[model samples]
Target chain A: MLETGRLDHNLGRMGERARALGVRLRPHLKTAKSYDVARLATAGEFGGITVSTLAEAEYFLAGGITDLLYAVGIVPSKLPRAARLVEAGAHLTLILDSVETARAVAAFADLRRVAFAVLIEIDTGEGRSGVLPEAADLVEIGTALEQPPYCRLQGVITHAGHSYAARDLETVARIAEAERSGAVRAAERLRAAGLSVPVVSVGSTPTALHARHLSGVTELRAGVYMFGDLFQAQIGSCTLDDLAVSVLATVTGHHRDAGHLLIDAGALALSKDRSTADAPHDYGFGLLVHADGTPFAQELRIFKVYQEHGLVRAADGALPFDELPIGAQVRVLPNHVCMTAAMYDRYHLVKNGALAGEWTRTNGW
Target chain B: MLETGRLDHNLGRMGERARALGVRLRPHLKTAKSYDVARLATAGEFGGITVSTLAEAEYFLAGGITDLLYAVGIVPSKLPRAARLVEAGAHLTLILDSVETARAVAAFADLRRVAFAVLIEIDTGEGRSGVLPEAADLVEIGTALEQPPYCRLQGVITHAGHSYAARDLETVARIAEAERSGAVRAAERLRAAGLSVPVVSVGSTPTALHARHLSGVTELRAGVYMFGDLFQAQIGSCTLDDLAVSVLATVTGHHRDAGHLLIDAGALALSKDRSTADAPHDYGFGLLVHADGTPFAQELRIFKVYQEHGLVRAADGALPFDELPIGAQVRVLPNHVCMTAAMYDRYHLVKNGALAGEWTRTNGW
Candidate 1:
């Protein structure tokens, strides 16, 4: 179920978009968090995987995946894991933005006589984790890595996470272009300093889809595109039909007085991730769907979430909950499918309305 | 650690309060989401347990723990799992507000002879789930067990989740009284109908702590007390020291431009569950703690969360963040400990500044 239906479509579209952009599609596995889904993603394609966790990279490597990028910047406490990945002969790229990190990685790798690929993250106007675009010293520090004991400077990557706040697709497009241009400019600045920037990466599912024409961006690293969620749908990146995952739930009780039906799948099952709530259509928890993959009537909306119960409210503040039986099974399309999927250790796949299989997930540092 | 310093103390006090009110505390297990901590809680003299998911209940029961209540109102899709619990000789209490569910459970249980201690969920105004207290027909429906082939009714229960919004202890106390009175009144109505109402339960962590007496309340359910978080603390309910568990993360990168350090712990590690953000001193994500569990320096705040990256904003707001050496391990106190812990497959116990044993968890339905 992890690699079914719209998942394949999304994966194909991402690859196609990458080809059209003349860049490598470095789809991060942190989105699906499923080995089966990752396998489908890499199947028959020259895919360079990006992972936020060492466990994910290790999972892919164990499955014969060689090209991988530990995209979430590495810290000193888990440097040993990064060194191990490089030692295991996996083509690993590490993300870092500080001279202190560079010095530490260099010292550790020098001791092991193994040089690793490192990318200095650049902040492209997004006040999140990254070095300032004008901070050329940060890039120079990466390039100054000691050969035997240090990491080799790769290119730079930027994630315009704030692009989701754009009011329209036009603004999102502008943000995407600016994000790509920023990373490219940083890479150009490094190249002028005589360093060969191998990979210029840009992220954020919204920006990636919109910035396919941004030429200087060598590789597109986007997760969550595999599972179009309320976030993606809200940003005008995908339609509801594009979503590949949904939380399976059951109607527990009906409030005939207030007009709502309680469901077993609440925040516990659906996750309390409301990252996309800022979007125009901010459903609190998720959109309720019938068991057959079709969404329920528009009258029903999951408006409130408790630790273990979801309150389905009607559009007009009255629950027409009589439409659902007390025991009917339903699927809830969560606010952020990436966070929602991460909550579960496995995915229960349904294809043609039949239980296909269970695809397990791995999680750790 | 589920049973940590300040949170342990708070839960202890709340338990005492509940016991004094003549309500046996069957605290929900969904909050802390740890068996070791829960076992420790039970060892401290809890009478029964309330679980949101059957998976949790099964995990506890298989470990020789019993007296369980599947508190998230009964749904038809999960009837078989509930029946299985009854078949295993576990004293199970099921919650549902509708006769439709009662009839369904009755039909399913009649065959298994699964005599369930069903609790008629009364809506005492938190309004997430349950029948309204004035829905007098609900009591008749519960006592109408002879009309069904499925399950038996035990009594009534209500959760005043809205008490969380109280501005002070006085408001929390008032809400608690109302909640207790509402459930008691419903039970009275049931008794007036010649129905033998065995248990009249009402609770919420805030109410359980502030309310002096339960009046006619027989049982208490409070989960978050075991591992209180920022949201709890913000309601003047718990303090910073009371946060039991935190996601121990590694400092991966520092955003100099944003004056923030990046940690591996993000929304995926620490849940985005901020129910009381409308309150004063609404902490974002959660407060960060040092290795020894003391709060991080005032300059450091976990301001924003990506899927797997916590942007630790520095107080100075400087773009020259190259000070912190990479690889520093930091522990992040979560917004809601229970939901955050649920995202992880296991717990890495940090006791006396060292990694202790690993505690595994069961996921899914």
Candidate 2:
């Protein structure tokens, strides 16, 4: 169940952070994938939302979100689906890193007689899916995108996803500065080549919070900060108390001798995300908090998990089995909220330690 | 999409092996979670199936499969739900490992005047869940389950999940032997105390495949064998070519300088199950193959993954980017079929290089 108070606090904090940074916050809806959360996120800011999949775009758009940035690198085969969304009166923007993808989208747009806005993805430092900022193909891709009959070069975007590896604010700030400078440089290069690049965007949760300045950047995109997790807590993105999302689990069994309690939330419920393993403090799967969102004994943790069973025990001391009897409910703060949240179809919102409401969530492409 | 030919082969082979071992094959429906696949698995045998959740129990029961074993340990709060399923005409068997759970179920059953059948879970060296075979309280727990007017001790069940850690045939067979002997010994101990323990079950994919004998075991429970994976193949559970499940993804981007191709199948598609990290061969997330299920160059693997982007590159040499251009459809052999399949709501089936059919699957509790 999601704690509504924490959710509101997280949303407000991120909104305020973005406002103070002096950049348009195009919050990525991939983490919370819920209409209600999106509404709260965009309440006092621009309504433009960033999505990771076409399914998400369709879902959010159907829920009345018009402005969307399909943030993932676009594939040629998926152009038809994107075009359909555009034709249906949605302000959809596709992102791509290669000249081949740009040409493919341009051809499809021309053939379908549809106008499309495209963003060139630049590799700041993550080295995952974007074109290198210094690569000659960046300008070539821009030129190919502009040759279209119905295509418009929206701008250039980059995500320093590797900033997740930063353990402190200093390192995160450095990476954020690098992400900003790189995207701004790429946009300048495109403009220098006579390309009408309108928007320059850069972000990830760490970079968004720590960016010294977004001087030449026009917009920022960040997910995960909407609902913080253990990894985020460890990386200084959010405090442990700021984690808005958690898995409500019951104590199913207890091994007194082994000093462990068996919880119903396992790999599927809490997710098999071991992202915090190599961090400063390793939270095996998640940190077990009281059902009311209070802290537990510092040593207790859900150290091991199965398909549908989690072994909760005290890693440093004895487990308080007498205090935590069978059938008692506990909240699990996941290692990565996005992965854990994907396993559930709905969120049971809790406020004042009671059921506040519920929100439907969508998953899969 | 599921490759039907390989799926049929996988099912038929398991059935034959179970018959040869003189034990009933109660296939765990957790992996596929599809009615069509369950039908094939139970075609030439008893229709009894095993599940990991009540949701699976209800889904399969609605599909007309009545006999089911909800293998995960039950918590007290879920009893009412289980009772409702029973009221709906399901011969659903619940599993528990502690006297506390047994008494809880018994009290609820007695209060509701509903007869419930339960199996005691024996640890058998997995150390994940279940009661230790030789624990002094095993008999006490069994006796508690048989108390009052509504509860029956159906039998004992144990899963040697550690068998997945076995690297060679000998280690697998040895762990399998331990699993068989441990469950048998627990049943014997109960019988010696004047209790009638009818069913004796034990298995894991590796143990089921390498069991030396099942002299005291009545039924075998196995899940992932029906859809072999890279981890299974590496641990000698199945041949790499025997893998029936794969994620169908489109080539989204190609990094010529970095020598990697990007696919739409990322952690959400292929799963972040890096189970084979320390195995004989470490397939980062999954092994990439042609859409027709043929292997590509031996070294190309999904070396890195984002939420919706898999970074495919050759670990040893150059990537086959020319052959696998943008928009190419590639099938990814996941590291764990159970985790990967849980992300999709349906399976697109293929047979003999053609589209065979599609099967709807259920997820969530």
Candidate 3:
């Protein structure tokens, strides 16, 4: 379930932060795949969004959002779908780190007779993907994208995904600077090689929120900020009050002898993303709260989860078994909202402690 | 993707095993939510199946299978949906461990004028949900269900989920015996109280496959065995060759400097289930294999995963980057097929090294 009031507050705060940083907030829709949330996130913006999958790109395009960036590395098999989106009037921009993929994209665009906007992914500090900002392959990939008449180089992009490891704001800011300088430097190198680099993008939820300055960045992207989770709250990206999404579970069984409660939300419902396990305050799987979005007097956490059941116990005190009987509804604020939200097909929107409505989300590759 | 040949072999083996053990194999449909797989799994059986969610129960009912055991604990809020399924010509059996849920189910059944069948969940040492076979409340929950005119006691059921933790065949068999004895004892207890306990069910993939004797158990239930995973393979439940499901991913990027390759299947596509993390030979996130379902010479595994990218590395040697370039397709055998399969809405069935067709699955509550 999603608390719309908290969602709005989170979205509003991120928008203001992006505005203050003087970068277009092209909110990544990967976290919230719902078009309703997308519409709200891009409410006063230019409707430029970032997607992790081609399905999201298609879904958002059908929802009347034109500008999109397929942020994942492009491959040959997915180009046909990308071409279809482009043919359907989507300003789809694809990203790639390797020269081989750049060549494949160029060749595919030529064969399909579809113009493709391409971005070279630059490695900021995250050793996950992308070529290093100063690597020789950076210019090679840019040059390859410039070869085909149907393919145009949009610029360079980088994500400081390692910013998620930041324990303090200063670390996040440093990662943010590295993200900005890396993308900007990669774009500059491509420009020096007589290649056009129009866009320079960089972001991650923590860095986007704490960046000292995005001097050379044109647009910033962040997804999880719109739906704060325990991991983000621990990493100083968002506060506990900013958490917008949770899994509404029913108390199904009570193991008073074991001093725990069995909830309907388990690994499948809440996801096995133990992202907060290493945080200072380890929320076992998630923090349990009242159905009306209020924290319990005792800190209850889902310590263990099976495929279809979660074991909830108080972190330091006894479980309120008397107050929470069988069939009682409780909400679990997930350690990672993206993983938890992926389990549900739709969100039961809550407003003013009442159910507002339901919003569906697109899933899968 | 699902290999139909392996799937058929797995179903056939489980069928033969159940026949040899003198028990009905009410194959659990929770792992493979597809009616197509259910049809194959129950080809010559009585059509009795088990589900973990009401959504699965409803979907299977719509697909022409009626007998369903919702193995999760029952709650009041879900009774209306169960009632609708029962009214839709489903013999939906609900399970609960507490008298509170049993009373709620009875009340809901009476209010809706629906005849609900219920089973008492016995904890065969899983310590997850379910009551102990010797618990005093066992008879109390049964009596509550017997009071309502619209509610009936179907039997007693128990799952030895802890068998998954067994490191060897002997331990799994031992746990299986405990599972069998527990459910039979619980059924005997209910029958001693003048209740008609017609069913005594016990199972888990490990228990189902390793049980030497299921003396008093009428039915066996197992889900993940249909699509064996690395964790199951490591626990001696099934060999690696019996694994029927795998994630088909495209190589998106190559990080030779880091001695790893990136695939499109990441935490979202492959799931964050680290079930095999503690196994003797941990398969990381998943074991990477060739597109033809053959293990690579280097024994590649997806060691790290982001939301949309899985970092594949060799277990002991250098990555075969020359053979696996960008856009190349590879398959990953999941550590836990149940969690990994939940990420996809459909399965691309493969037969004789070729794409056969697609089977859609029902997901969510």
Candidate 4:
């Protein structure tokens, strides 16, 4: 859960950043899969929301967020579902990194006599998805989408997911620059091939925050910035206090000999992300905080976790077990807010140390 | 999803094994969180069921699984909910690993005027929860539960979770024996103190599968075997072919340069449980299979995953790219079924190459 004040602050910061950078902020709604948060994030508009699944696309579309980008690679089997969203008056956009998927999208659109807007995904050094920006495959995919009456190349989108592994700002900025340049170059190539690649998008929380400028980028897409996590904090994207989301858990037991406190939150509650394992500050699973979402003791962390039990202890062995007795409620700042938040069905919102409201979120594909 | 025939085989094997060991099979419904599966696992009896959460307890109770044991350590805040289940004619059994919790349960029962059946969780080397068998704390917890008219000392329960880390059958057997002996010893100590400790429960998927004997153990509570995973297969608990649960994914794209196939299933669909990282066979995130759940390639696996994209590649550089083309359906044998299944609302069942049924599941805390 997050305090509305802090959440607003986080959202305001990102919104301001997008304004200053002169790019449309198409916030990815995958992280905070809540209609309430999305409404606040997009400032209550259908203005270009990004989704990772068709489920999310449908969810947000039903909530009146009709302008959606199903950001993952589009497959033929899922074309009908994506088409249904488009049929329901959603300006849905599909992305693909391969010509095969592009052809499939073309075929599906041709068969169904439906117009489909698509983006060519560029590999901006992530080595995970997309075609290399300089590769001939990028032009091939763009050409494949451009050849039909039903298919049109909307733009090129790239994600610098590798930016999270950057240890310093200079590296993050460099990766961000690469991400921006790669997507821009791919878009340029598509334009050179006589295709109207209208939109250019690039982002990842670290890269989005560290990018000096958005030269050819038209819109910024980032999700985790709204709910900063320990991984982002360790990477210098956000401060520890900037983290908005925290899992409220009850202390189940205390082991005097082992010098630890056990909480109800575990792998199921906090998730076994461990994204901070190689970071500067390794919060074992998550950092322990007061019920009001402040650090309880210096360097306290959840050192271990089972399916339903989290073993909390001081990192430097200062031993705060006596203070955190059984039945104590503590908030755990997650290592990855996206994964942690996926476990809970709703958010128990707090504002200035008081229960404000509860917001329900959707999950699964 | 699982093939019904394979699931039946897995369930029947475990049931037969429990019968052969001369113990009651109290199948833990933590893995398969479906009423359809639970009914089949328990063979249509409210005799006993082990759950990891109160959500499961309430869910099963609604479906007539009355005899339930919450395996997680009981906390004071959760007592009212557990008491409600008991009040609703559920023969619920509560477990506590601490004297403070035992006293809290006693107080809750005493105040409510309800006699609660309680078990002292014994640490059979898992150390995650439970009192050590030889420790005075075990007897102390038992003594606290023995107070008249409030709580009755049911017995002791231990889980050999350490058995998962065991590399050999002998080690797993030894851990299973330790689990049995530690729990039996705790029960014996309670009996020595004139407490009528009636039951001794112990299990873990690996331990339950390999245990040669259960001399004094009254019941074995094991989950995951009903939906065997790669970690269990790597630990030699079950063969790879015996795994029942798998994520049905569609190949969204194929990157020729990267020599990998991208699937729609990623962290959200398959979950990010890297439990087999240190195992003999590191199946990456999960092993790739055909539409009918047969291995596509001998060593093909989902190498890396994003939020909604899975990068699947052959481990030995023998790519099967052409075989698994775009839009092709594939089943991924999960690293851990419990974590993977937690993401989906229902299991897409297949029996003998046909869609049999879809079983809905319970999730969240």
Among these predictions, the greatest lDDT belongs to: 3
Task: Give the per-residue lDDT of model 1 (tens digit) for B48-125.
Answer: 888878888888888777889888777766777877877787888887777766777677677677777788888788
Q: Give the higher-lDDT candidate: 1 or 4.
A: 4
How far off is residue B134 in model 2, in Å? Answer: 2.0
Error of 4 at A109 (Å): 2.0
How large is the C-alpha RMSD of every model relative to the true structure?
2.6, 1.3, 1.3, 1.5
Task: Provide DockQ values for all models, in the order shown.
Answer: 0.70, 0.77, 0.81, 0.69
Q: What TM-score quantifies how close candidate 1 is to the native fold?
A: 0.94
Q: What is the DockQ of candidate 3?
A: 0.81
Q: Is candidate 1 or candidate 4 better by TM-score?
A: 4
Candidate 2, overall lDDT?
0.89
Q: Write the per-residue lDDT of candidate 1 for residues A1-365, one digit (tens) a residue.
A: 34277787998988787788788777888877777888887765676788888888888888777888888777666777777877787888887777777777777777776668888888887777777777857556656653433567777988898887887878888998889888988888888877778879997788877874778888888888888887788878788888889887777776665667777778877888776577787777888777777865574667787777888876665555556767777788878887788777788787766888898877655
Tens digits of per-residue lDDT, candidate 2, A199-290, equal 99999988888878889888989989988999988999999988888898899888877778899988888878899998898889998988
Error of 4 at A138 (Å): 3.0
Q: Pick by DockQ: which candidate is best?
A: 3
Residues A1-365 of candidate 3 have per-residue lDDT tens digits of 79999999999998999899998999999999999999999988778999999999989999999899999998888989899999999999999988888888899898889999999999888999999989988888888899657999999989999998888899889999999988998888989999988799999999998999998889999999999999999999888988999988899888988888899999999999999988888999999999988999999999999988999999898999998988889999999999999888899999998899999999987
Q: Assign candidate 1 its CAPRI class.
A: medium
Candidate 4 pairs with clashing backbones = none
List native contact recovery per candidate, as a fraction of 1.
Answer: 0.89, 0.71, 0.85, 0.58
Q: What is the interface RMSD of candidate 2, in Å?
A: 1.0
* TM-score to true structure, per model: 0.94, 0.98, 0.98, 0.98
Candidate 1 regions exceeding 4 Å error are A1-3, A146-150, A297-299, A316-319, B1-8, B44-46, B146-150, B296-299, B314-325, B350-356
